[model samples]
Target: MEFIDFFILAFSAVFLFLWWRTCFTKTKPKNLPPGPPGWPLVGNLFQVFLQRRHFIFLIPDLRKKYGPMFTMQMGQRTLVIITSPQLIHEALIQKGSAFASRPPDSPIRLVFSVGKCAVNSAEYGPLWRTLRRNFVTELMSPLRIKQCSWIREWAMENHMKRLQIENFEQGCVDVMEICRFTVCSILVCICFGAKLPETWIKDIDGVTKEVMLMTSPQLPDFLPILTPLFCKQMKKAKELRKRQLECLVPLIKNRRAYVEKGENPDSSMVSPVGAAYVDSLFGLEVPGRGHLNEEELVTLCSELFVAGIDTSTSVLQWAFLELVLNQEIQEKLYEEILEIVGKNGLITEDTVEKMSYLNAVVKETLRVHSPAHFTLAHAATEETELGGYKIPTNVNVEFYIEWMTEDPSLWKDPDVFRPERFLDGDGVNVDLTGTKGALKMLPFGAGRRTCPGLALGVLHVNLMLARMVQAFKWVPKPNEIPDPTETFAFTVVMKNPLKAVILPR
Candidate 1:
């Protein structure tokens, strides 16, 4: 009887120890940030997924409850949201190398990126560096941008002519749609070295939007085990890829053939002194990955077009919306443009720099209506401390650009649309790069992964806005006020498309 008692006691002790280890020791991290309590196995997925209409809207309330930096578990993935600009500077700029890599993509994103072949989604390594370097030196450099100035001018002319036609025919033009068409035309010209017909541009734009929608987070992304149940999404992704290839492959191949023959293509949009972006890609040879194949080339070009068109269009649309709402601000901008470039003068690259108020208007628009709510997710390469909180290796860190830009702590009257704030104050010398100090705003992001298209994007916005305000007077339609309510597509866009009357000045 004593022997049986001893065995029972030992077995009970062992079971208790195992239970404690599994339930307590292994469940929580030692120094994780404070966040809302979540359910077993799912974490905060349900709470987050429920707010899918505008998930970004929840951040402010979360910030109020959890403080500046906090954590949320999305199934098995840990997400750390950093809202403080100082902390953002520390993580994305000070310890940039530590958080330079990207987390694994959702299944649909994997397919859309063509196994991460495009520069934006490519892993941070030799391939990404090579691709980004190629883009900066060969395409986005000041000299290169100057070379491509005519493309923007030509695109603007087309945009103005179309606006006039639409205004005459319809009385009020859908500014959002016209902006998309104009931006896409410019990107198409740069990407393929030719001004494609409207039909081809519309086809590419349609496929691009479809692919972006499909790539948004789905059930299978958080629970990979459920991928088999999401085969329909996979099929749609493949179909989108096929449609994109059908439209893009022919252009890429034709450009490649032209370069291969050692003959400069007779395209009006191609720069006389340098190769087109597609031609530059044909010459690129990564360290491990050899020269890009046809499909890879197509993917890269498609990414360029989509990235350039979407965010710039959104920004320009917001600029117009704001200007129409605040006619006084619009008139001030018009006065500045007239003083610098004159009523009938062309707004060239050189002239754009001379328009300080125009620059301020663009800066203010970026601050108030940032195109993206979050920067592309950056993953910690190893366990580290951020804002004095422990961040585990492979954890996703997202910087909320909209929140940072509008943080009342940083800017005075952040909600108000005031361009003069950027003109005569501390913001007068605010640097977008965040190199000199803490970033006041990151419209193009900051650090090693800063957007390679910053100069081009800014130039496009400045010139387009200058010409539009100079060419016509923008007024809200009768009994219809311009609503700046935002909705998140791939880019955050105005919930209602901006529709207004454009009277030629």
Candidate 2:
């Protein structure tokens, strides 16, 4: 038995080596981007595993050694990480269509993304367009968002009161937990078209987070050939997906019933009925795929919660941390808020636009601490050339967001947290939409695949920050400074969650 086991291991290793050499080396395309050479069979897969959670930290050193655009062979998967802003512009903006689609989802992702049916993971095509259009037109339109101001106001009031209560009772609030609930509360209303009880919302938040964490990149994600060995993990992922459906499918059914009756889903709230994402999907037909089934509806609605919650929560957490650390900046922002809207004025969506410094602060936060350190991997639709290198069809291209935002050549004093730069210097007339010219920074990404919720996301951050500043003075706890060291979750979050003292004005 021992001899047979050893023989099987040796044969498997030899087969993989020969397969790698035949497929990768012999059939390699000319002038693929330069990168660190890898071992015969495994390639850089071991290095990725070695770095573990800190793999993000290794990219900068690799960028310094290899040029801006480089490749890595992760078993059968080939990834090109692009750090040069010009090269990013060339690939994502200049030739956007060639790089519009997402790479194929892994097995775990297939369960969550429901076979690429969600907007974020769907391939670029008529199906993607139909879904994206339904989302933007029904939910994200300016009038629709404006109608939902009551939701934000409701969440903000509850959030501030909760924070005040917590600060009084426990002396410090858990910023991430409290802020996550508030963001989830707002998104829950938008996605389900109804307000749910706090406990119910919390349950939904927990399950969605579990799904997100489970779907993160794993060894089998990169090396599909080894998938059979990780049966337990795959099984766990399916269970989580089932749990997610259990939490979300009921909401989808409720919305469908409400739409069928032509009645408002949430009459208690003044926001327009039939504007919920689920409501819009009831009778909508994909060009080639006909009307979406219930599971697809649940998946798309789940995408809303998955996409908006963490990214917005992380930004709010980082913005407050920065405000707590930089007292002068905080004071300046408060003074501007007072001048524009008065001491006790509520920072509504309409009022938030009038505050230039407030907008600048959010922009600076996004630049310094982009919630997503890297854009979602984009796959090439066909063979293309970028930065004088050949990119073969279906290869994943990832842009390093932090590198571009912090590059010295792009912004003056790039490391400094100076919102004034946008008002006066190199960031002046900068376009967040990469359509104008060379890319400066992409917080929500660029081109056809750009986040449709870009405007809503910025508004959420700006409104939350302004109201927090107006209602209370944020300061670090006694002798400790707010630690801004980043750790990766679904989004880049503070390693040390911000714990601060909030004094009522």
Q: For this target, which candidate reaches the highest lDDT against the unseen true structure?
A: 2
lDDT of 2 by residue, 48-123 (tens): 7777646678899899999899999877678889988888888888899999988988998898877899888989
Least well predicted 10-residue stretch by lDDT in candidate 1 = 266-275
- TM-score per prediction, in order, is 0.92, 0.95
Clashes of each: 0, 0
Model 1 backbone overlap count = 0
How far residue 386's Cα lies from its native spot in candidate 1, in Å, is 1.2
Clashing pairs in 1: none
Model 1's TM-score against the true structure: 0.92
lDDT of 1 at 421: 87
What is candidate 2's CA lDDT for residue 200?
82
